[model samples]
Target: METANSTHTGSHAIKRQGPQQSHNHPLRKDFFDSLSYWLDSPSLAYSSWLSEQKLKDSTKTVYMAMFGRFCQWLNEQGRRLDQLEADDIRRFLDSANPNLPQSRKARTNSGRQRQQYVRQLEKVFAHLSSLGHSGTNPGRIAGYERIGTGSDKPTRFLNREETQRVIQLIQTELDELRQEEKSTDEWLKYRDIAMIGVMIGGGLKVSHIRRLTLNCMDMVEERIDLSQPGHAHRARLLAFAVPAVKAWLSVQEQMHGRKLEPTQKIFEADRSSGFGRNSKTVTLSASSIHRRTQRFLAMAGITGERASAQTLRNTYAGLLIDGGATDDHLVDYLGLQASVTAQRLRNAYARSQLRPAGGAHLSKDH
Candidate 1:
């Protein structure tokens, strides 16, 4: 083991040291060493492991920051990496000081952030064990019993009236766009309408929407194939016979001036030169879809709830359940891997069915 110097800080003192020399010279051992003076060996080892995995630079940066914070916390606790226990990990997440910096407090407050922290720690411990430096993974134990309740935000879904109003709004916008001369804006408007139709009509996830290609749609069959590589659930077909969907596709074909190739992305990024200008095809991001959906929802006067892609998906599920789809049928239609998820959806559907009764029953009887 190589040692450099030690500096005593307030509660946590960082012991600076050089990483063990490796056969791979270009691994940037010093860069990882600088991430934290404490646990330099493990951090450096993890960096090398990450490099071997060929992660992107942004991903590497996030992992490095997460690991550094964990190492700093461990140093404050006076515990070695191998000395960690499930309780120790749990306490670290549960105990938050009000006196801490705003950023630190915010990070601890977020359930999502804590979940990400546990995942990062798990990766580091897994790597350490692989290198024969550790035998146990406390992070995994902590994750199994993770702290914090799941999201409390109410699930948002469009009702019959709201759904019809949104459909009318999209039609109105498309009609206005069609009247204008052919332009990039006109093409993008059609794309947005098409994207919305697929999301609400097909109940597709944002990831599924982004992965859709021209070949995925079967106009003759009036269905869209959603069989993407590496999806958790089995690939299933979705009906796309809705008039909005047909109109969107028709406008898209007109915009391109020809039939799109099988490999071309169905929903693509807007460019100044219009659709299919350059050889490179850029797909719309999830965030882009979300922003556009929010705008459309506002136009339709929908407020006080999330009106994004997921809401549309939930709306689809609600509509199906109302239409007498069984749990097993829902599992297949929604491409859910487990029946338990369908059960949960069923519970949500039951909750949505409850309504206030009229006061006629409470009236005095003669």
Candidate 2:
């Protein structure tokens, strides 16, 4: 029979390489391509370089692809990337066409994708600046006016019933999966169940769970800390700790069975389905998170109130409020941003609601 030894060497062992395994590596087919790297000036936006510090690769691929196309357009116009002035960059921003071509056009991502592309161009210039390769970053040609997303729809989130249903649905799924004896390391049902459990239960951002390399989780200490990307005072820790923990012991067991190293994916994306375009997906991106939660909401048969993952988080906070937990306690327990939760005011308001169920604040009769 034919073997690796027959094909290239004297050995007959098979390597683990496959279509899925080698798909998501960062260095690319056209690593030296004219797009991501400008021969004269690569990434130059100060912010884009900083963005690279936390930029998701899926988004980067879009950015790089667009940049390549843009550079080619520039070349056709007898211009080079390094030589573009702020005015040149301004022209590109003004040249927006909703029906922009896609691979030449990748699948066109609307809404947030367009916003991020603007950010990426900004960062490209930042990276170039850091390398002393470009003169000025032009991503901020326009002020902070919102990009035209063709809609003013409210951000969707879960309401009271859907939240309850998600909890019940997960519980049901876990119980059924464990009983079926179908939960081998290969099957991965219980693991999936536990993951959904803690995420929905504690209002944990699923992105936080999925981004976990082994280093991001601290099982012995019983805490999970995922930092949101930003240099501002508002950046969140997303810490789930003792006394009121977000993750459970059950989830830890699942993590172990999944063969997840501290540095490996704790929560993975279902890349096999349309849920992902690439394989390095361990969990949903910070962007797709809202959509996934909506999927969960749909499964729970709970559809009212603009259900979203963040809505689940709000429900968690609401439960705390209903359960008489202080807002300060809720903030710390849920790792909320200060701006997002007004601990002092919300608690005072909650406390006032506890005032003897009366319409009048003052009593005329003792």
Candidate 3:
């Protein structure tokens, strides 16, 4: 029977010692020939390095597979482990074959796979640096930090019925407030209605809404201009939302008992000391607006991870897409920095159209 001290040691056990050998080890170049050789045979040194990272078993397998491919590629390029530079790493990443190849021809790696490869290389180079084998972490300088997975969570938007229910609830409350005598508390409700109306009608971001001032709204033109110093959007037309906005302005004027200055913020927190002659006003914070919007959503029976003002803006964008607005129109209307973003939103809208109304799952019978 074989014993621990037997001369019949595993082939991998001998090759695995290459990674842990001295920096000037004679067999160092052979180790880079193909990490898969030792990995498939089960390397003690590679397993130890993966264990030191405290990674999951599945993650360790993925990392080892990617690292093995990289080592093989380096060997093909006649590149030594200690002589790597950032540019060489970048070239390899751009030219490397995809792990899951679709055809015989080598294909470029996906953004997600590229990110994973760079991350694995970063760990490898860092380990080598600690061992005094490599001078610099070329993986980090190869732009791992800048690369993204190129995937985003599906966008969340309300259906037509849900959107109308929320708007109806707001209009009902706004009507009730108009009938009641004006007060400081009532002004907040008016502001919330106007803020939500603009969000749904204009697709403005939370930051744009927060920084809005009296001068930003041209009620006569039924337009909201956001070309203010810090705002990103230029202007957005307000359709079907003019009444709520005008009502809020009237209520605000009466609450302050004077004409509102153009510079006064349109959405400010209700002051405990009534907004009378000399009361100081505080701007409504982003959280305050989110909470207000969330309450409206809860009242309308719409609840989810995305039950906030962003959902309202998303719904607004969906409306524009459904109305046959072009991609360029969306880019201008939504103030999106990239035209690709408009394309993605259009794709999302198309995907939403394929789903059952209100996002219901398909029945098994179908």
Candidate 4:
């Protein structure tokens, strides 16, 4: 057990509550299927912590998926898991190619992205050696690549108008449902709208919002307490209670015509089944969130803007940062997945604010 001290911004590791439990615990079974576990002891809560720490679902998923695919490939290639080395990764990076039919889904810089995955692979390799799974970290990427080999690219965010358009579209969709009772289950509209609103208002990432549990909220305090995914030291908090966000959630609860329990997911695709994913309850995946975001953006006529829930979150950051929100504020407020992630958004905000309006066209003759 771990005993942690709760600070206003983050939790501190004060002391060990008791003996460290083995990673072989049943609840965390098969958890090592993730490549990250080869680096450290497995924990079911690690994903949640990672989600919080990374603050981007796609980011978290992409790396996990990439590693998963590679490991699966290794097994098929008649290679022992322990025998896997940096050269295997290097070969994959060197010959990285997207499936021809699947190229339609290819993101920009397909080769480079695969190569970048090699870096993460490097970390996991080092970790595996530490964990006694391998004798050598043979899979590490070459040194020249780390300092920007022209393959690395940054992620993008959105603007305020774009953000408004996303919300507006979702609103329009909900309103249409209101006009013609899309389904007897009216909570769908309420749930989506409220979810988007909280996400936008708080500049929250999908993972941050998705992992939310019923017990984390304190409606009376108009705040929600986030317990995990600490970024650095200061960013980690015992709680992250935003009063404005609570207002949105409150309205959602009222519209549902029932008080929300602390144990309920604030946003549920299915509000029934006791608000848990049981044997019967269908669990939602990261892709579902992406698809829903696309639908909402298209409905709002902002389909061309971007395809992500985080885009709206970024839009919120850009809007506020442009309007004078500080870089530090944008970083924490948006739960940025990386330390430098806010830089480009900050640049966008500055560009939007500082760009001259068609230039000052006063001539000396005039």
Candidate 5:
């Protein structure tokens, strides 16, 4: 058996704590398939650590989802796991708090959530260290102890009035656009409307929109099939988004000057250089999509730190909860990696219902 501090030199270097199987484990089983789908390339070190953990399946699922989010955050910060230190872990925890960058006195206590995250990372680093993958355990008790706990905050989402205002703004614009003859501007507007509708009505992420293909939609059934690898939800009803998407598709067909291929991306750069089979036109970059979504919100008079595509998605979750969706159904509909987000949105929706019109409060939680 490999000792705690023992380092391995070859494939056999990283041994399991319990019985060692004759066949080597593939980096990990498909237990973390969603993580693999979200990541450009899943980390072998992460796989190894998760494979050896003794947690229950439910707990493991949550940790896997949390890790996926952490990896995405690290990418946004332009940091790599191998180069991370305890400070980076701390920064990540702080950033995860939506109420942050404000005075400490104004911040809601999220110590318990932070502590749990630290524990998960600690185990990850410990296992990765034994496998000779990491030099430090940034997720150690020091990080955990430094965090302060608070009651769970409800998720931030638009109320009914705000939701209506946004929808009305978009609809008015679409109606105006329809009055004019077809033009490049018209096509772009249609695309944006479809994007906003999918986000606010269908609850898709910005990343999902960036990678969506034409085949993902089923207009006949008013559903979207995101059943491909990495997505937790196989399909979701489009509900109110069907008309917007259909209109956009019609516009796109005219703009592209041909029958759209199922394999082609649904959204692409406005000034794509080409559109042939060998064309190099690509989907809007993540940043571009985010900025456009922000612009749309701004046009609708929705401006704030929360006036982004994610808020639109959160609003969709709130709508579902208000429409009598169970927490489990909300989780599945949104393809959330964990049920925590669904629960938070549910609570937020409930809180919104309880408040009087003039007594509304905004949430710092995202």
Candidate 6:
């Protein structure tokens, strides 16, 4: 029996494996036989179609896994791939059995997972239609309302006061580190302060922050050049300077015992990661940056699920829009691919601008 990982072959006669026997009792043999045939042949066509569309390998892998799972489920229902109707697809998504394992049950019940399954199956069926193997793509039926995950929430950003408080917290930490006499502590804190400044002041995504090198900044001009190759947005200038960032540069130069070179990563990891004068460049991972951001947010008494590097970015966007920058200007400034995202930020900014009555009275008396 050909396993899911079996090599692709042009032959239609290849034997395909069924679901594990322990779980196969519910499925009809004929359904498995049909599924095996489709998996061995039409699935190849689906793969080819995916490649033709220039999808990444990771996307292809995800879709293939989704197809395999769908086939297994279809066999359990005594249905062939070609026999599926829009109602059948909808029913499969709607029905959730408690007898299944926790993980499988969760996957089945998840609206997001169901949506992904529907999307992938749509592509697969479209490929089958293109090959004249199927006449209809059940996945595309109108009025087939997808299960709403209800997980999405509004993005959060710091207001001007909260933003200033966070900066003060970071500045205090940096000042403490400076007196510690430990070079490592000072260097690391400086890096942290610099990272926060770049995110809040420049509105750079985590990827952009990770790729920044020493040369990206122009101290004389008080602007950072983000026009590096492979950047998502066209190269643009962010016209703000964070004093903490410059302070970090000075500390970095002193720590290195020499002037830093332009080609080196701006936020390189510490010595524990083998970052040294003669070593190749190494930047902090996105996850690491996120964890650090959360930690700092907590330290600043800004407690919320949305206090993240992304929130800082949102804060930057909010500030820009509040300052009367248009959506087009924001798209260019943030290196966004579309004005829709900028528009969303603008809307969020507008909402944030609606202050409650007596909001100033709630502040601590100085």
Candidate 3 has a TM-score of: 0.54
Candidate models: Cα lDDT each:
0.58, 0.44, 0.62, 0.46, 0.61, 0.59
Per-residue lDDT over 1-366 for candidate 2, one digit per residue giving the tens place of the 0 to 100 score: 111111222111111111122233455344332233454444332223444356687766666666655665566557655545333443344344434554233333355655565566666655444444423344432212122232222222344455567767776665565566443343344444444554545546443454454454444534344433221111121222221122233444353454544445555555356522444344544445444555666787754444445445554555656656554455454654453343543444344344443221221100
By the lDDT metric, which is better: model 5 or model 6? 5
The candidate, 4 or 5, that scores higher on lDDT is 5
Ranking by lDDT: 3, 5, 6, 1, 4, 2
Worst 10-residue lDDT window, candidate 1: 357-366
Q: What is the C-alpha lDDT profile of model 3 across 63-151, one tens digit per residue? A: 77777777767777665665455445545665637555567436666778877866766666666654444244556644422322332
Candidate 2 — which residues are off by over 4 angstroms?
A: 1-157, 185-188, 215-223, 227-260, 269-291, 343-366
| Candidate 5 C-alpha lDDT tens digits along 316-335 | 88777767777667756776
Q: What is candidate 1's TM-score against the reference? A: 0.56
Candidate 1 stretches greater than 4 Å from native: 1-150, 175-185, 228-241, 273-280, 355-366
List clashing residue pairs in candidate 3. Answer: none
RMSD of each: 17.2, 17.4, 20.6, 14.3, 15.2, 17.5
Candidate 2: residue 67 Cα off by (Å): 17
Least accurate 10 contiguous residues by lDDT in model 3: 8-17
Winning candidate number (TM-score): 5
Poorly placed runs, candidate 6 (over 4 Å): 1-62, 65-111, 114-150, 175-185, 228-241, 277-280, 355-366
Writing each residue's lDDT as its tens digit, candidate 4 over 1-366 gives 111223354332121122223454335334443434442333332343345444477888766566555655665556544444333444444343344257553443354665566566555555444434423333332322121134422233444455556656555655676577544355555556655655555554454455464565545543345533453212211112233234345544654455655555555555465543351123334445556666766776665425556456555665555456555655555544353656756665455444443222111100
Estimated TM-score for each candidate: 0.56, 0.44, 0.54, 0.50, 0.57, 0.55
Model 3: how far is 257 from its true place, Å?
A: 2.7
Which should have the higher lDDT, number 1 or number 2?
Answer: 1
